[model samples]
Target: MEQAESLALPALLAARAARNGDAVLFSDRKASWSGAQALEIAARRAGALAAHGVRRGDRVALLCTNRSEFMEIVLGCGWLGAVVVPINTASRGMQLEHILRNSGARLMVAETHLVGAVHAIDAQTHALESIWLIESGEGGETHNRSGAAAAGASVAGTPAAGAPAMREIAVWPLPPLGEPLAAPCIGDGDALAILYTSGTSGLSKGVICPHAQFYWWARLTAGHLGVVPGDVLYTCLPLFHTNALNAFFQALVSDAQLVADRRFSASGFFASLIETRATVTYVLGAMVPILLGRCASAQEQAHRVRIALAPGVPGHFQQEFTERSGIALLDGYGSTETNFVLGGGVADQRAGYMGKLVPGFDARVVDDNDREVPDGEAGELILRADTPFAFANGYFGMPEKTVEAWRNLWFHTGDRVVREASGYYRFVDRLKDAIRRRGENISSYEVEQVLLSHPAVETAAVYAVKSEFAEDEVMAALVLREGAALDALALIRYCEPRLPYFAVPRYLDFVADLPRTENGKIQKYKLRETGITTTAWDLETSGYRLRRT
Candidate 1:
């Protein structure tokens, strides 16, 4: 395996395309493009962007779905030495405005249906210079003139008939320009991406992932996942996420074919797997439960999938999934701030551990003071990679956040964990999500894991809420399996013998569904918001009480 420093992403991709021209590289539900064809598309898109005055280091905001166009824009930006800012589809007026303004994007490429929203926000933003609709039509042709005005300008009356509107630019579909613009002239230290955090903490911050950081992650993940030429890497996670882009790089660097989807679909996942002949896929924990809920068939077991890199897998379902699907599922632990810090490799596939830290990376459990905690004790998981390669440059445009996260020269992950005797790390919970009651630290992840083991429980999120006693208390929001129902008392009884008195949730709220991030991680922050004031259930006297089975 080649080291991260020795490889440039674009060069590696070009080399692969040259060798495997005819291999299928990307596929959606409608069409598939060969490696050679995909590269050509990227080249053309890059040329088109350049033609539109997009230069090296320019920020291009991509607000589109999970399609070939998204990949083209990303790769094309790489080829042009431009930074790609992928906006979440879920973002609306203000959120979209914040990202576009903060990124200092010169141009935006959005889908036709979303043009109205963009136009609504574009009037208040000054940094956006142009807008291109991916699905343009006669109505969408006037997008530029459709806006109220530039920032601080007022719109008085309706637009005059036949007045000139925003120029509708054609989608440039050509091969990359001459010499691929010298690899965008970036060093290992240059910022490559400005990925906005999902804003679970109330304010979204752009994480500055530099070239060397991304390269390091891509190289290690590709090697760890055993990506190779002619293999089809399936990606259904949104390209806006580090997971998708990281997997994209893994496939690109290894000369492997890529099959992308607009989004992960429980109904369409197996079909897409067979359609694309995908050899490897990255699955989130939320996706696993969704797939498990679907009825199993022999067809699902017949797909070409060999490996499933599913992160955040709870303890009980790990074995069940492997037994049923005949696919090896490896759970890893990582965050957007830290790319692929710890993962189970081909050599080691433990049941409930996130494997040991990778070479050149150091992991330790630390206390609030940043002192190393003794092994086997749960504490904050702090990790740092060797030198400047594996670590990110900093949070983009936020000096305070960057300094806070990188305190003492180590990135504080905010996740709590305990190191086992076998060198494996067991995830306990997030430090903020941990429950503190009467001076005892309770892991929400541990409680949720135990709750998931209950045959009736489909999903669970445990968090802390202010109690009437003026301290925090353990509260649980649960989703029961289809056709299964247990009252609140029944659940408490079920957990009585399984958990310690302090760990058992005093309050329980049953919901039809839980909110999730685009990558399928449970939005515990949302649950915490709704769960804090919820008086739906009473432990001492409630209609929904669980009885011993």
Candidate 2:
């Protein structure tokens, strides 16, 4: 199947399905879609979306978990040339509302369980034109017309259509499998999707990814990761993120069967891998220690997994992990803003290095002035690919922010690192106050601001410290107000309901004073160096757990 004329994702999938109609394309517990079956579902979904007034360039928000519907919508949106906005299912009412409003989503497809959360924001958001609930049952409660129509009414003594009525649209079944749809008139510059960054770094910004960007990234990833057609690639990462989506696309491009999990579970990981006979899988450094800490069994080493693609693995644990698990751990470095700048495939395995830069991309270690630093000198990592089509279009709705990242003709990755003479890059730390935990980015400034909201908290500084397992873990250093004696449990309780789980500081260090620079800025580097000191209270270990609070 030639991709020259049909470079769009939908067209590519369609062409592939036509070539391999009966091949198993995707397998999940809820459903298994063959190549032809998936293509038909995508076509029908495209028709349904188009019938609902979704057109080219229109933003359609998908707030569903990892399931068959998610894949169908992703492929279908490509056919209609509409930009898909994949919302994080973990986001609360306010976060969801911000994304919907910022994206100016004309349509929102939410799951049955999330209907309540969607309705909570329905009254406040004016941009949403329609809300379609997935998996609605026959005897399900009907949409409240009063509540739905009331959204159009003004709360400020004026009338404004806040959101359209939550309607139970008919489920469109998959159309008869046919030859792949002919190539649509699309270009490398067309906006394909907007993946919002995890709000760990302040408010999340929607990263604009085009069809060409995804296609090239997928190609490079397949080459770098050594993905093959017969390989059964298993993915548990949320599809909303670039890593998961890239994994899925790379598998598809290689004609490999994808074994998907609704959500990642440390306990069920090995079982799923063995059951699916997964030959390859992607993981974050945080997951590595968690898996290793779990009760080791013969079955863990018995799995057919040949490669574990991990990022940000600590230098010391690399050898121990490989020896214990009998599976090679291939570590690489990249971010949502830029895809696959450097990686080591199955063939290249260095102990501590994050492999050499891949073809089509240029990498350099630069100092504070953006000038190239000598080899082995630590500096900010900046990457540029010759193919502009491979890079992200820009951050959606934020021109200044987009320009800031893509300035000087190089995509500035806010990571600090050093490159060795062997071309392998070593990650030092982040220049931006962003923390990477469990493959998720968390902003130190954002968490600090949230912690400071407590009445007893005079000031707070958040930073990443080395966890016992291997990767960085969130740790907070806080100073209580004068005459106030708030303990760690109270502060943990306060943050439990306010922030996402990853953003919640795992270790709390209560201090009388916080280290700061002369300019009055908190010196997170110094705090990180000090590590976890305050053992006055261990909240996470104190059995103070809340179920989805």
Candidate 3:
């Protein structure tokens, strides 16, 4: 345990399996697994990938929710020294296609419910060779139309030149075990995964996370959360994000139990905590405030959860949540591209301020020209690591972007923060066109691009409106073509299939023209300040439901 400095993921997993092979590592409502059992099972999956021609450094796309198989697939890919590309399951149409093509994923493993989205994709464009389906255990027919098949049916890949003979193989309905193969020599700096984060400039960029970065994330966070052996780390956040993945590794570092579900349910949050007897967990964005706002239940003060790692909870809500739920909330600051950079415990944390910069990171707040702003003045937050591999290597496959981001020897966060004279950083606003709804980071640029693709829209300006929850809601103001008329519901229907549910504009305004600067730049800040106009189309009140089909 003392020799943790040089260890990477595979080395860590191998050590744990040897140390406590039969010990319980996962204990959720659905199933349970021992460390040894998980290792052996995931090893077979590694062989399966190798058998299918996947090799070290190969990209394997994963479209999964919060299933145990998600972790297994990560482990399997790590065993083969392959880089896993964990895409957001809510991603549909071009958003999904962009990640597929950008990552150049050779193979993809998706849940049965999500396979349709992938099935509709033009595989050749993404260079996808094959796909394996994970049966959802919910009784339903596979989406393949060419033949009637059972759970393990094989469907042809979308026809295109240079595309592999694509087969939708249902190879994961049940866990398969095979002989464990020798793992390749992988180092701490080796790339573990490529996670696509919403770019402020509107394009999604892949953040390359190295294994050592993950190791430090786990170690540092475990120390912060006071995780101990036999403690239960309950999480329901999707595994695609760095937040949940950090908690995942924290459980491993502490040799604690993990209870995870596919997603968060505000109503069921307390009951699940009691069910798993969770000691520590995570609550991001709207979760803590929403839970505090929920109708009081008999189970509110009855759960075993003692501490919750709340990244950005409002101070008032943090106090209220503790008084109501008997759970303490701790605030911290980090992003997909960085680990826990600044944070403190409940006692040290002040309301409305991000804690001081943590060890292993050098932090600064700088103006546009990379000059450090005076304390108490708003500026962009930037960071440099004191330890190697503590942050992402770069945005994957984006050399110019990488150079731009690391310019002036610091990673520009594009987040406006003010370093108070007291040294606590206060988040002011985002300096980019992005929206955070619930737990999802949505690119306003991407949403605008989708809206412009519609025949009726001549120009679109997308921005964030304040949500009842702590996060923001997406709003779009559109300039319709001359004599063009698009119904709100019709536009909603168009977006349902193309954009993720969160990215779909909840409020739309058809305007004659958007406010522009002298340089003809659409002044989104003006629209954002104006917020939902009286004449704007309100999708929620209009009874327009998201259609999955």
Best by lDDT: 3
Question: Candidate 3 — worst ten consecutive residues by lDDT sum?
Answer: 139-148
* Stretches of candidate 2 exceeding 4 Å from the true structure: 1-5, 119-126, 136-184, 198-201, 455-458, 479-487
Sorted on TM-score, highest at the top, how do the candidates line up?
3, 2, 1
Instruction: Estimate the lDDT of model 1.
Output: 0.70
10 residues in a row with least lDDT, candidate 2: 149-158
Q: Identify the superior model by lDDT, candidate 1 or candidate 3.
A: 3
Q: Model 3: per-residue lDDT, tens digit, 1-549?
A: 133745577777777788777667775567788777667756777887787788999999998878777887888888788999999988987798889888988778887777677766665557676667777653235444423234555454355566666544333343364468677788888899999989675589999999888888888778777888888889998789998887877776678878887778888888888888888988886888788777888798888888988887877787788888888777878887888888866676787887888877888999899999999899999999877787899988788998998998799988999998877889989998888887888898889889999999999998999877888888899999999999888988888888988789999999999999999999888998899899898888887587533
The order by descending lDDT is 3, 2, 1
Return whichever of 1 and 3 wins on TM-score: 3
TM-score, every prediction: 0.72, 0.87, 0.94
Candidate 3 off by > 4 Å: 1-5, 142-175
Displacement of residue 479 (Cα, Å) in model 1 is 26
Give the Cα error of residue 163 in candidate 1, in Å: 24
Evaluation by TM-score, superior candidate among 2 and 3: 3
Per-residue lDDT tens digits for candidate 2, residues 294-386, read: 787777787888877777776677777777777778777777767777885767767678888887789989987789999989998998877
- What is the clash tally of candidate 1? 15
Question: Lowest-lDDT window of 10 residues in candidate 1?
Answer: 150-159
